[model samples]
Target: MTAMPPSSPDEPLQPQRFFAVVPAAGVGKRMGADRPKQYLVLRGRTLIEHTLERLCGFTPIERVIVALAAEDPYREGIAILNSSRVLCCEGGAERCHTVHSALNSLAGIAADSDWVLVHDVARPCVRVEDLQRLLDRLQGHPVGGLLGVPVWDTMKRTASDDQVIGTVDRQHLWRAYTPQMFRYGVLRDALSAVLARGELVTDEAAAIEAAGLKPLLVEGAQDNIKVTRPEDLALAEFYMAQQEAGQS
Candidate 1:
């Protein structure tokens, strides 16, 4: 990866024309894997490698910057992925913080209007069709967007004591997934606001919301599940197989 000259803080931010940011620093405790879920083997390669493989296929994306855990325990994973045009950065304790760290690495090159699609590295089955779906939807809107699937299963709510409370109204519910697309400086400002308010957000869109901007939710697949647990690995493998077979 070539070093990007930092942008001048005082200069007007230019519209971004290239690049994507990926956050891959989680410890993967829920995955029950000794290695980070992103580095875990999938279909013959690590999950992150597969994720980058899909992203690298997109001609619109010029470069990919991965936000990883400091000390980067997955040396083999890194070496395998090094051939791709992807750079690495250290992540923070929290998910959004990791994205912020990746954004900071952009220096002056990232502009408020330039697009940055922040995705979860653990999810290796992200489809090119789904990404195209998002780009098409965002092209018609001012604010950027992300991938989301509507709730299709039965809903349930639990009580504090672990008793069944009632069925949650699933009417307006939608499952949030990556890649959450947005502009660079816009996201930076939104994150800064969240930090100042001492509030936490579950995703980049939430921060964008606090900034009074509404990001478009392009329909995505439920098949794009985050590999957070051991059982999920199998499901992810199946999903990825379908994707590979062009079943998506």
Candidate 2:
């Protein structure tokens, strides 16, 4: 599943425009909340609202494309989506589907070589400095990459019966995080191929790997956590407060 190169060596390099895609279609049943976990309020704002505002505040990103569920009623209250920098499209049932749909929605506007950053809507604590670092580190890269942190804890492989099968190596293992950046054409094609094969990819980097390419890992702060369970809301709130206090 090797992807064809977008450009040959003879062609002059072109400036790649940065665009963001956020998959906000999931119901997040694990949280056991009345509504989608993204709609859950944190520090007086919904999770999606904070996430979108952080991305929108990043000046390098030209546009932020948000993929919402077809019948999403919560987005209407989010005023930031009305900004010229934001665009909305109907999302699919899964994260991969939503991302692929979002990419398809950008067909006319995005060039093949332009950068598309796919971020999670639950991770509202992504830092602006880390965003800039990702772009800087991946500049002129052959295949794009994502922000991640190395696994420091002891790893274990457990069986279905909750028995420890083996102690896995923690080395060379990392926790993948967003926004996973890749070329517009490469990512779109990768996700399309995976979906066509009826394969589910946990992240854009995994899809890129399936396409026979290695995505670089840029070390980022651990504070950029994705809010999944009910307790994560408090952690995210604390992280945000810490970030703000540090700046102040």
Candidate 3:
């Protein structure tokens, strides 16, 4: 939970640059769609397109690196992938592997102190205000954090037989969401260590935690939902419309 020291008034302060990474290698079997879920049409554009636009349009971020399946065919059709600010690389099978691959691609370009925000391609409704909030809150932090929301639903625990085992405590419980921000060196080393142990972390924050650091979870809009399954498409569409209408 350490933060960087404040610079002296007489000395010039060098701000760390922000970079974004996206892992779009998943086929999203749960979506039951013809193509990969990221390529699915949303508001007349692919989900990946919307996501990239959001990240690329953000003023703080300098470049966005997207890791796609080695044989991905849909990327070329999306014009945004050709943007000079967007870099593409071959991805691995799993989410962690894909993210690690993107990090490897960033080597020699991204400095150790640079900020890297890893976001999900399925989350097209992520708000810019949340991204700014994460940066504002985590500025100069030694170990970065992510955008999340407190879980307000009733707790439920089920057994293999579908019987309720017990009701878990909900206090201080939160749902982990994407755009998990961390220092380039810390994240890369943490992921490398986890990968060396053959451990699969579902998110960047987990890898940071495994490295013996706590990631701050900044409260974010609940509308930043991950689009999964057939029903999620409609839900995402609704959220997007709300966002555009200034209602979200």
TM-score of each predicted structure versus truth: 0.88, 0.95, 0.95
Candidate 2 lDDT trough over 10 residues, lowest sum: 1-10
lDDT of 1 at 186: 76
> For model 3, how does the per-residue alpha-carbon lDDT over 117-155 read when each residue is reduced to its tens digit?
999999999999999999999987887999999989999
Give a tens-digit lDDT track for model 1, residues 117-225: 8888877888888887877677524567789988879998898988888998888688999999876777878888897788888799999888888777778888878
Could you report the Cα RMSD, in angstroms, for every candidate shown?
A: 5.8, 1.8, 1.9
**Residue 206 lDDT (model 3):** 91
Clashing pairs in 2: none
Candidate 1 vs 2: which has more lDDT: 2
Error of 2 at 72 (Å): 0.7
Query: Could you tell me the lDDT of residue 124 within candidate 3?
Result: 96
Question: In every candidate, how many clashes are there?
Answer: 2, 0, 0
User: Which is better, 1 or 3, measured by lDDT?
Assistant: 3
State the displacement of the C-alpha of residue 188, model 1, in Å, after optimal TM-score superposition: 1.1
